[model samples]
Target: MLVYGDIETVQTVKEKQAAVAALLESVRAMPPGIARHGTLVTLFIGASELVQGVVDAGFHERGFDTLAPDQEAGMACLVRLAQEVDRSWRSGFASAPPPTGALSGLRAFNPDQIIRTRQAEGYAFYALYPESYLEAARSSGLGPDTRVIGIRSIGMSLSALVAAALGAPVPFTLRPVGHPFEREVRVDPALTHRLTSGKSGAFAVVDEGPGLSGSSFGAVADWLEEAGIPRERIYFFPSHGAPLGPQASDRHRERWRCAPRHLVPFEDLLLGPSDSEGLAAWTASLLGPLEAPLEELSGGAWRARAYADEAQWPPANIQQERRKFLARAGGAAWLVRFAGLGESGERKLAMGRKLHEAGFTPEARALCHGFLVERWHDARRLDRVPVDGGHLVERVGAYLGFRAGHFPAEEQQGASLQALRHMATYNTGQALGDEAAAALTTSLKDAEALEAKVRRVWTDNRMHAWEWLVLDGHLLKTDALDHNAAHDLVGCQDIAWDVAGAIVELDLPEEATSRLCELVQQHSGYPVHLDLLRFLLPCYLAFQMGACHMAAGALGEGNEAVRLRRAAERYRHLLRQPGIRQEQEEAPAG
Candidate 1:
């Protein structure tokens, strides 16, 4: 049920400021655009991190509100920067380096871990934006004196935006430590007194989600209420309008049920007061006029339209799936999928261009507001098509080999070998039994060294047979972006992982699998690591099993859940098959 993995590093105020300085340069160099918006937002976020780093380190020695004069000035400077974003900076904003100097004090900072804001990173995911928070805060009836407590990581940036909108100075931020479902916040007596003593109209807690549990918000609210601040004075700024999930505690549930919550819904942000910048217009801006309303295609809905057998459709985690829609522009239809915003969006756009140019994926058109438009092939799923095993091997091999040769990682990313092993064992143990789990652990016993040798890349992790489009006997991969950096433990991995996936998903025979490996070597000039392939096959199976099981649990007992459970069983069965981890020499036992 818990599926999140992001690599975040601890940074000192000095370290953060240096990065901010670099980001400041990027904003100055770029013109008004998606790339610039992402850069400015990242810079703004780093500014808040730098401010919090100083306050967290020096709070013990300082009074309440916990900011020096220079720090306060730095905060005001951030507000000024934020104002530019509000004034249609996308068309044209100040082409100047953002303000700093006041926050340059390094001796005051001790390094603290900063959580990665999934919304901000790479901007290719999470449609949540700071502008939404700015709008929400503007509507809240609070003055500049409002006490804003931002949850650490994402809250750090979102809280600052809310405070800026309220004309408040240096809003305080905290990280709740403990259980995901039952969180707790710790504030010093003096700090608590300083925050509580003020006649601040209200206390605003800023963050993105109320997620499976609203514990993060609850923890902050609990900290305030325990310190004698009334619950009525505390407000929440969450991105979604959905109530907390089933995981929320009774107390946290009740608190969220009654708290004054504010947000400028995504619909408002997408459509605006007029429909000028709405999805249809956005699509038209890229590929002429649209002929139909953007047809909703998220959560594997495309499967229903593509295949006839609903019972055999692949499992898709609806809540975790990205936003997707089918946009039509006359004779040609385009699938407008959310790719991301900012640098993340740009990076994906560029990478997608490379893939499309190489004839491996659907052609990706323009990227606007974190969404990418691609040519939709009116093609059947490969599984539905009569596929020749040799042709399938050659196509999959060439595609994966191209990815390996062209997209090698400079540094290893994603879960460590040990972590992957642990996930495989733990998940298998839960679904199957300890014996089946131990089998996976045994296969991975020597993979620790393979980690050092494995060639890492941003892999196309979704190898489900249904993920491929067969347009006139040619295989084109879909959904090839952002899985390597998804909110999941799989992260990035070896090219062999994809090979393992292809073999398992397509159920390739031994001769075909070896041919696939040989074709990969021929295409990329990098020998497919047979040992690593053998090791990862079961780990890949275990991951699929866990994913399907989780989906099954979330959906409960329905036809969909039944399909998911069967998929989970199928993966379990695949893991037990001797053919899955095949090699000419000593391979994993079936």
Candidate 2:
């Protein structure tokens, strides 16, 4: 929950614009294909940044709240920018440059700075289409007098579609302020006047979620109602019509229960009768004509399909898992998983290829519309199979080593030793006790120097037993890509992270842990620092515990949530009693 989307980056408009310009040049010159699709996604990201920058500038401008004539003109420009992004998306999915330079001569109209939010489900984890918003709005019975308010940051783009659908003026976006469970929007007198100036038929609120909490929507509605807008006169345009997650407050639940909310489900958009480019259509392009209906494989559904008995299924945090489906085509079953759009997807796809080529993972076929279709192995995960401790360490070592050596990043973008240690100690104190946590990191006397010694690479952040697959006498790693670049604090890191992760995840003893370290050093030529691993084991445990807690909250009070909570405790146990790690081999020769 918090791990992925919580991390944010701030950048100047000029920097992003420069990136856009460079990407545009590359995209224009490149041939139409998978690689070109990545360039288009990069361009799309840059264009999106420019749009956010302009919107940010407007809100920061003193007179923006008043709905001044100049500000409205700027809003129109924002709409155009959104349109440009849509065009780029079209090009990306088509894997071809637009007939003309789509927004090639896009006017310079952005703020000095922009705050970028990670686009998770819509951009990375799901096949959510912006067009779905347009469709959702068109189905509504709202009048043109309805005031359209978009919740930033995604709502900024989604509001455009809703406004266009209702033939309303350009929509103004508001960023909800505060906690995920309780949010409030601070509006100036002028913005309030514009919102309440006329007794509009309704005020339509637009955004993608009703996520774990519908607090963002609650914030906007709370502001509007306090401003004297009648509840009935306000419409909710969430991405889905489903009730909000269990974390939704009573106020939000009651208000949303009777509220007029509208949505066009992803199911409809992707599998609707009229969908021309649905999952079946696009997936067929990758694996030939489909011979079966797509099977849902996310939320640990793959366990039911792959394993013979329910007892064999490993517990997974349903909320944090990626979106994937099973497709049978070309005489074999394949997995069509959401790889992400543009750069995010492209990067993950590339890693998937690397993992496959290294003989550590399954083969990926092609990327179509941000989804990667790969050979779906029906192999049982390590949990269901007899895991040979030595073999497990060997496979995990070579896999982590391959990742460390082959997937080096340009810089040390991962969480630093100090940061990781602080997080570990703090989180462990909260979860276990302050005394136990401090000792785990005591060996890291000179954190800065040790951190400086470690090399940075796109880490294999996921080293759980579920990640290992026993297929065709080979141990294949599933979900090999996407974690490092995911919206999380654990970005690129030293190969030490993976080594430590493998040791903790498998609860490896000293001998096996030493073997893993040895295999990793042998394969990657990256020295294995036992002292560093000692520091990292706690850091890794703490991070996983935090992630599990966040996910458990999102999942609420289900068996799955309970399972996640137990997993968090398991992580805490490892933190409390740093077991076999205490019995370790000497640090490998550098």
Candidate 3:
């Protein structure tokens, strides 16, 4: 028996250690005969020596012989496995000798199998960048017309070498839009035009493995289609299945088969049927299902409904008036931030459409608005203009009304976490202050109760927390949350609770303030919301200082008096603005 946990997926050193430890412990519990011989293999491709050392030490301490294969060793292992490939046309897959150890299964098949399979199919190889398949691709003796396009990273470098070996006449590469986790794959427009410009032949889109989503291949397929290439010309040659070599889903195969596109499984070329099926079943059982496709939900019709709901004031009407009113007024994109009676009308309208399309309509609307606070604050800083924060509050208040009527208990709890975070980071007290506090208190109480329910439901279950929030897509308007998301919400709620406690009394500890600000800044960079947190840092600090000074009073004369005056000055400096200024002005001076 062998156990392996690739360290690539984890985010931190501690997490990697924990994962290794868990694997070791699991290995320990097996029967002595099996456990004693079990070799713990840690594949640290592209990992640091420090990480490799830690994994080695951890495994060594457990009295297990471990192997952390290097690039040379890994590539050597692939070549060694490829040596046994039966290139003869008469050799049936079953007649081929099975590969074992370092070259076992689709996940660890010989990289050369890619070129071998392509040769067998009579099509040119198109290796996706970032997989260790180049040595095999290069050695396969393909003609000079092979074309490979991928990212300009290490995996792609190896791929390029293989392409060069094949005497590839034209190889194209482009930087993907963002990190792989970001799931944003847009090939450069120039690259797209270049790829589609003149070449005409059957081309295979090669990738190392079609992971759970098969998204990399899908992205290329989409790009090719957009570039006006017939889908029939595109062939998907995923070298392996997903990480654990899961079976390609019927849906995934169906998707690729559209427009007569072919999905040629390299596993079929690389592994015997029994071993491939066994590995596929094992991985399929492990991963269960991929995230539901958001595209399946209709976007156009939902956008229409969202537009119709805004019958009161269409953005087009506002834009028309803006053009009529101001001679030098900019376009809608420029005016969207400032053009609204309450919230940014254009933003709200656009976000409403996004929410509806995502199937998180009613509840997502709140998350979307919270996202805007991030944008508005960023614009405030970059533009160096005092934007009205009260408008944000108004949008939140409307969402609150919607939440009260439509949100499930679980969703309300999740929203409560957002509410608490919003209040703490944005100084909700200044704009909606007392009202915000009252809402925070109530939402916290609800979340605390929900937290208790969560504990009771999963007391002994160590299931990953993300599973708790997978919204039922069947329920069109349900909140989009999974247990993992639920856990995230709870964690944020806990942090927000601490920050809110400190802010309400103006006795915020420096540590608490720093933590609150850190979280806000970290979350601001998240894809869903940009620049939405910590917009009220200065205001909150001033409020805290004012409260401290007011509490100290005349007991501390000179410095305390100075602090009090400064606090008052900060209050005057606060940009209450056109939204809340009228109500604030009429109130008694504190």
Candidate 4:
């Protein structure tokens, strides 16, 4: 049975023509069994006309007798449901800002790049927008018995994809009313009856973009909740990234100032929200007006069930803008490992470490360094005391330091400070360890005095609110130990490998327990703290696993011993490096 819905799918005259062609092609290819059902459901006259065309053409060409929605009882029910939803939407109209916050730049909506890497990476591409959306009935984690409800258009597609992935049938769609972009959605009485009649359980709420004017998706979410569905059980496979401002703090409050809570911009879905509204506005200006509710909204067989509303269509210029935007679509922000809500230093560091483990050293270093630099810059910006001086003096003194031939005192602390100190030690002209030691001692001598001065500057009641804002915000965010943590974590791995090699080759046992405790004391938060736990556990596991294999004689031939031996040799070689030698020599002499 065909279910006809909204008329907004085909707006301008050109779209009408295209819709007709696509409908004919899809209908002509319909399976014999489905055609034999003889019912083609449509929502409004605009949709009914197209179905009638398809039926007339089928009969004239192949002697097939297909019934239109109005002619069949089951199909008529669907049309009635669609109209009921439309009437509800017309009663309530709320305009919302476009979901432009997500699409802050031109290169934010490319699905191709994201999908291309899906096979090589374990990203949730197909899971997010299942290819079998038309037939899926359930999702994997949601269990086989679960059912889903979708918002019309994007939600419908997402539900279908999710259901298909779960080896289920097409999910039910909640018909939207009024302008599709900013409509109030209503649950069809029939659907409500079907859900309420059920032996009561949770169902999923699927939508492509949670655009502005959340009433459509919100209606379904509310209905599901009211129907006794647990909030967590109401699965939201929103194809787009979250709407802006849901998680924004004062720092990023202005990021997507006017972005709609429901709207999911193609840019935002592919790329995380823009850092600034100017970037989002510029992207909008470049792309022109928003045409379709989403860029991926297309003329699929399922979409043909809905009718066209010319009056509610976006302007021609907006249509043109969409075409132009699609023509230049390049990269998606979601393609990257992490692109959501708040900025996460832990996720960034983990990603960097993962890259390093995979032998992508340059990328790993770059990722780690980028995060460090960002944090350091944030810290420096926070150290401002406008009453003490303005931007010029602060920048010069914090970075260049007033004294000649001296490093900026600001550089002594923050996320990258440890790495900077290490680099300095390794690259200096001093003797292997003596000069580095002397420099560190000298730097520490002034530490107590610098700390007191810093505390006074920041806590001084004379500072303006704006100045304190920067200072308070910085204090809350700056991490002074991330670099130290990274070094220690990487060092632990190296030491494990070194100790293993020493035991087998040099017959020496290198103690690692004390060094580990010291490392933990250095980096205590997320990525670093968790990283030590994750990396250290794996190292111990690998060592034990290899040892067990050796003891069991599993390493007699082509077993893990061969791999362990190779690992030992690799570590032996690494330990001979100048940096490794320095680390071992300067290891507190314990």
- Which number leads on lDDT? 1
Report the lDDT tens digits of candidate 4 across residue range 52-135. 232233334433222323123322322332332222222321212112221121112221211100010001111121222222
Candidate with the larger lDDT of 2 and 3: 2
TM-score of each: 0.88, 0.86, 0.25, 0.25
TM-score, candidate number 4 = 0.25
Worst 10 residues of 2 by lDDT: 1-10
* TM-score (C-alpha) between model 2 and the true structure: 0.86
The per-residue C-alpha lDDT of model 3 at residue 44 equals: 15
Residue 537's lDDT in candidate 4: 26
- The alpha-carbon deviation from the true structure for residue 19 of candidate 3, after best TM-score superposition, in angstroms, is 19
Worst 10 residues of 4 by lDDT: 115-124
lDDT of 2 by residue, 435-552 (tens): 7656655755568877766788888888888878888657888877768766567787888888878877777877787788788888888878776777677678889988888778
Per-residue lDDT over 1-590 for candidate 3, one digit per residue giving the tens place of the 0 to 100 score: 00001111213444433443443344344432211111111111112121323333333354432232322243333233223221111132222222224222112322222110001000111212121244345434445564555332222233333444454533443223333323334444664676677667544455454443555556666667778877766654444433311334454456654633222243332222442232222222223321221111111122232233322211111101110010011111111111221112223445444545543333221211011110100011101222233332222223222322232232222323233334333343543456754553443344333333221111101111111122221212211122112212121122222233223223334343333334432432211011111222222333333333333342345443454445444432442321111121111111
Once fitted onto the true fold, the runs of candidate 1 whose alpha carbons sit more than 4 angstroms away are 9-26, 29-39, 42-80, 89-124, 272-274, 308-312, 410-412, 578-590
Please report, in order, the local distance difference test score of every candidate based on alpha carbons.
0.74, 0.72, 0.30, 0.29
- After superposition on all CA atoms, how large is the RMSD of candidate 1? 4.2
Query: For residues 1-590, could you state the per-residue lDDT of candidate 1 as single tens digits?
Result: 22456544454445666776787777777776555665677666666556655544444344233335544555555566565555443343344444444234333334453322233432335667778888898998788878888886667667777887888866777767678898877666787887888664789998888777888999889889888888899989998888888899998888898989999886687654543466667678677877766788887788778877786576777767788889888779998888765446666788899999999999988787668888898789887888887888889989988888888764435677777788888887887788987877887798678876677887888887888999988999988987877767877788888988998889888878887888777787777777778778878888888888887887788777888888889987877763643436422221
